[model samples]
Target: MSLIYPPLQAPKRLLFGPGPSMVAPRVYQAMTQNVVGHLDPFFFQVADEIRSLLGYAYSTSNQFNLAISGTGSSGMEAAVANFTEPGMKFALLTNGFFGDRLGEMARRQGGEVVRLAKPWGEPYDPQEGREFILRERPQVVAFVQAETSTGMFNQAKPICEAAHEVDALTIADCVTSLGGMPVLVDENGIDIAYSCTQKGLGCPPGLAPMTVSPRALDRLKARKTPVQSWYLDLQLLDTFYTGHKYHHTASATLFYALREGLAMVAEEGRENRWQRHQRNHQAFVAGIEAMGLGMHVQNPAGRLWTLNTPRVPEGVDDAKVRAWLLEKRGIEIAGGFGPLAGKVFRIGLMGHGSTEDNVALILEALADALKA
Candidate 1:
């Protein structure tokens, strides 16, 4: 077959999907600047500034905060591979797909995985997990703070408390939670937490911002055997992220973009940014209910501020409606994952995408798509 060139310009999309919410203009501008060597003095300063912002974003004073040169899933792998050894018991609280994925990755690294599960659209109960952990007594308890699959926000305080009661380290997936809502990693007693740039941070995906608490760091240093994944090994990464030992080359351009994004976040102010998402969610929920659509997670308090999973109305093809909205209105949403697929539509109100105009536009487009 002859080679074919694609269109010169891509279609303009209003991203209101699972992640990769709309990017701020400054972040976009940052990426278009002239490139610099990864180890250039100015780029090194930029990287250090990004790390400081990551510390603030994660709401921790951790000295080990830094961005991995990969997606959020890579951050999960790094967390698991660093703290877990072969044949050691690791506990997971699985309420959605990502939580289960964490358990799977841990198992692949030779962890004896034990899962505590709830239904697909429900949140895992920390009290129940506490009882199970007391019995299983795993070395680590891992879970997703915001279960993106079902739009359920897993409350971390009680879960972290439960895990600590059993003397297990806590690893939280804050991929969808970091910027939209309050993470409070230090106050919540989370041993390790990982997030991505694309979701609430309002930047294109590239960096996995993570923080490992001092306790978790100590556990890694005390591990009986060396971690298996060399690329994701915490020992080498720690030297670079914590001690500035320069372990591997990092992308200076993406760090520039990330720095710009974090600056935007600071300008908005964390509390105000969080309030914007919550207010937008409330407005959207009201609009969706007015259109007779039910939410998948009935408890409003348990719903995620960043991602909303609304039940697909009866007699509607979920994917068909999504396609209609995208084709006709340039709006993009997501369908549910795993067992929740086709049952709900996932709408994101995050970062720069979380605005009254975007919310209204999406609701109007969804209404039109449903009627057609």
Candidate 2:
């Protein structure tokens, strides 16, 4: 086979990385269905169903919820760009990589960005975050509800409340939280939140499921300047998804997969699904502890249930272990990055990938890899 066009055969690996997690069989089947035009009536019906289903996934009734055509970062950019304009003061709470990405997006949009920085793998103190928001008094505030790089879950309620108190619109990066845990957009007062299908939603990576509160939407529509990215403009997306107008060629195959994945979420029941992920995470942690390995996050409550980060033992090479799992065991997992590089292993038990058997398999394989 040519190097550029290699053979289609691929090795099967148990995905335990941070994202692009194992997809459900049902979602795969759904993708094999007939393809329809982006503007087809049937496609519109599917789109409508997806938006409605996304409401259940995001735990909101904001009426402006829809999937962005790009990945989770795209949704993050959309959320940042739509509400923030030139000269606006934007406050970012950064504890991990994605939080910094938000600040970058805002800066690119010509917003004045100020940030409160914390060590990676540590969730911010709610009071400290609130104080920063109030002190900065930014027009827009953004934070990561679930930090993918470090497996930390920051509290959205306090952050959202503080933003509102300062009359700032809030954006939450829920890329790793949406399906595996409780986002509680309405209850948490999250004005805007976005997630990826590949992580908690058990679908492939293409769509970014997003929700925007009326407050944020109003601010977006009444912006003094046009949104920076035309492709990610919420107003245009609103017309495309809700108004049935031609904007872009959205993938019906991907939409089919998303709709089916979301339907599975509905069938499994949101609360029930969250419980399942929680149980699997606890079990996995117990197994890791039993193996004399420690977790990356000190506070158990702040750690992510969907994505777990375990401390790498002294004298053991993290990359070698991950390589062994891939070459010898055909299991795919991830190593830590940034300040966490070579110090932790980033393992995911998200969406369809979360299960007792999978947990046991990883533990056994990792133990063997360590022994090897």
Candidate 3:
């Protein structure tokens, strides 16, 4: 029997989950612009604009910055596969799911993995990983600046400082922090940083905005071995983006969306954007506390402004509450992952999605769900 369906449509949802936050109407309109060929000069103009805007979004002056034609995981894998060779020691300071992901990718790249592990919800003190870096002297040191799974924010400065003392390159997972909070790529001395266009950037999921410092670019150039993945090879990709020597069929449609989103970021000003996210986050936290719920990240300073993890109340099924919120309120929030599964809810307040009214709306819906 053939299946029947109504006209294709997406259900209206208020995205309060970990990523792919609510896209602004401006970005949506940009997506509707004429799709140009990747080689078209108009496409290149948009691509060039995206490159410069990525610098501003990431707070970096690095020239080797561009959006990878894949998601955040692609960016993570590229960073690992390009930097580490066989038998090279790779130190991963992991406190959450994304950090562990980096370690696994490095190991697959033949990196000698020594992961400094911690519980899921705990934030990292940059000093805690200093001794590990000092002892290992790994060629590549990687960490997640924003632990998306647990709403914990990790500082990169001291880790970068310690890694530099040993001449080690640093890779920061800025997927959750970029555009929502401060990544401070230049100030923290991060060698390589990667993030998704979703979440903090107030765009849909498609591209991973990545940047490499001059030092990291130099390391990449001097590497004896060919980069494992041809598609993710930054040098070849750079030729396509900068030299306009078509290496792949680039998505000019997504470029339009990103260009407009970054333009919004530029107009808002980076500091103002950070403050806006933080302010909404605080309001959400206060409302949650008033509802008798506690946050998973106990340390207030380390809590992320983009993603918030609220602890599941005693005797409450996190899944049911999430389901109720979705079915009854038309709101979408996320549940915890890995070790913290069933323990917390992941609420994302990112980019244009982070607002006073959203905080109020989600809080009200959450309170009703809990009561139900």
lDDT by candidate, in order shown: 0.88, 0.92, 0.92
The number of clashing residue pairs in each candidate reads 0, 0, 0
lDDT of 2 by residue, 1-372 (tens): 555975799678789999889999999999999999999999999999998999998889988888889998899988988888899999999999999889999999899999999999777888998899999999998999999999899989999999999999889999999999999999999999999999998999999999999988888878888887899988998998867998889999989999999999999999999999999999999999999999999999998999999999999999999999999988888999889999999999999999999999999999999999
* Residue 115 in candidate 3, Cα distance off native in Å: 1.3
Clashing pairs for model 1 are none
Which tens-of-lDDT digit does each residue in 297-360 have in candidate 1?
Answer: 9899999999999999878899999899889888889998689888999999998899999889
For all predicted structures, in order, the TM-scores are 0.96, 0.98, 0.98
Q: Lowest summed-lDDT stretch of 10 residues in model 1? A: 238-247
Cα deviation at 318, candidate 2, in Å, is: 0.4
lDDT tens readout by residue for model 3, 1-372: 598887999999999999889999999998888888999999888888988999998999998889999989999988998899988999999999999999999989999999888899786666678998999899999999999999999889999999999999999999999999999999999999999988988889998899999999999999989998999999999997769999888787788888888999999999999999999999999999998899999999999999999999999999999999999998899999789989999999998899999999999899999999
| Candidate 3: residue 288 lDDT (0-100) | 92
Model 1 stretches astray by more than 4 angstroms = 1-8
Better of 1 and 3 by lDDT: 3
TM accuracy, model 3: 0.98
